[model samples]
Target: MPPGSPSHPALTPRRSPLLTLVAALVIVEALILVGAAVYLLHGLLVEDAAAPIAAIAMVVMALIFAVGVGFCGWGLLHRATWARSPVVVWQLLELAAGIPAFSGGSPWVGVVLVVPAVVVLVGLFVPSVSAQVSR
Candidate 1:
């Protein structure tokens, strides 16, 4: 197949492996956030009236983040250039959060948080992924 031809992998604007990985990570993160939001909302409804405002606030934050991340992931899968910046910002935030979590009592939580952020950041910055997104 010729370059830029429909069947030519190099010319096709397809999701590079790295981009796919980043998108998958973002989607997974969104799902987790959504799950947390659901759990928080459920607790708010089922539990006593203590700290209802805090629980409501957390639920709202989680839902908002879940939607944002989910939208970014969808854009990434579609190769939308605008998606890159937000994802990068999110990864940086995640890294910062992970660093603190790492020092806390739960090392496993830190590892879980840090590893995916690092992977997604590296993947997003890779030459192939960048080029694909730039197209």
Candidate 2:
């Protein structure tokens, strides 16, 4: 703890199961992004493979999801108290998206994602986890 070295208090790390749950969710989101990227890349390169506009849209969506996961991951890692609410919102959106994705032989994808979503939602509601995140 050398104060003259200019350590940042804002960079302090907090450990919590909730953060782990959030990290899991981020990982699941990255998997989904990879899946979409693979499909989109194939579509773009193949001759008359599929609807070009639709393929492009999927790639864009994947990029957006990746960016979002990064933002949420940062907040969770930093243990920002206010980040919980937005993260919860992201989980709900993921839940909605998982419905269709899981139905088409994507069960594992949904399972990986939904587990963390549940954890995050529960943590946000419970007093103990909330207090830890607040710290």
Candidate 3:
């Protein structure tokens, strides 16, 4: 088939394994955020949150970030170069949040939050992944 043909494998650049890993991690993070948003919404609707307004605000924020991060993951799958920066920013924020979890006596929570952020950050910077996204 010609290079431009729909069936041609070369029509889309191949995603490197590291790139795929980063994308998958980002998607997982987005899904988790969505879950968090739902939990916050539940609190606002059913439970007696001390600060209902604050809970509502948090739910909105989580939903927005979840959508943004989800799109970033989709962009990565499609090789959109613009997706990389937001993912990097998200990982940084995750690290910041994760580090505090350790000090709060929830070391397991810290590990859960920190590990994937670190992995995605490292994967994004790998030579192969860098090259892949640049195209």
Candidate 4:
């Protein structure tokens, strides 16, 4: 088909595999945050938690962050260009948090946190993934 024709591949952008992977990773991260928020809420409501107010605040913040990340992942799935930077920023922040977990005597926690961050970070930059989102 002609380059600018309706039948042209470029005219109908397909989601690349790497982009799908990135979106899935981001969504999973958001879900994990939501789970953490639920845990905080449970502790605040059902357990003798320290500083209940702080725990409530933490739960609120976690839920907000989870919603934001979930939206970003949805945007990425739809190939929205604006979603890319926020997702990248999130992965950077995740890496920052994950690295500290290692020295905090939680190597497994560090690995769980770091692996997806690294995967999404690399996937976002992959040529196919980058091009897909840019469209």
State TM-scores per candidate: 0.84, 0.68, 0.90, 0.90
What root-mean-square deviation over C-alphas does model 4 reach?
A: 3.0
Model 3, which residues run further than 4 Å from truth?
A: 1-8
Pairs that collide in candidate 4 are: none
Measured with C-alpha atoms, the lDDT of residue 82 in candidate 1 is 90
1-135: candidate 1 lDDT, tens digit per residue: 777677678866556878888899999989988998999998999978589999999999999999999999999898889998998999898888888886788788788778988998999889988886775
Residue lDDT tens for model 2, 12-120: 4456676566656665666767777777777798857558888788888887877776667666666667667677788898788666768879998787667667766
lDDT of 1: 0.87
Model 3 weakest lDDT span, ten residues long: 6-15
Q: Where is model 4 poorest over a 10-residue stretch in terms of lDDT?
A: 6-15
Mind giving the per-residue lDDT tens digits that candidate 3 earns over 1-135?
Answer: 898797598786677988888999999999999999998898888988999889989999999999999999999887789999999999999999999999999999899899999999999899989887775
- Give a tens-digit lDDT track for model 4, residues 29-114: 99999999999999988999989989999999999999999999999998899999999999999999999999999998899889
**What's the lDDT for all of these models?**
0.87, 0.70, 0.91, 0.93
Pairs in clash, predicted candidate 2: none
RMSD of 3: 2.2
Model 4 TM-score is: 0.90
> What's model 3's lDDT at 124?
89
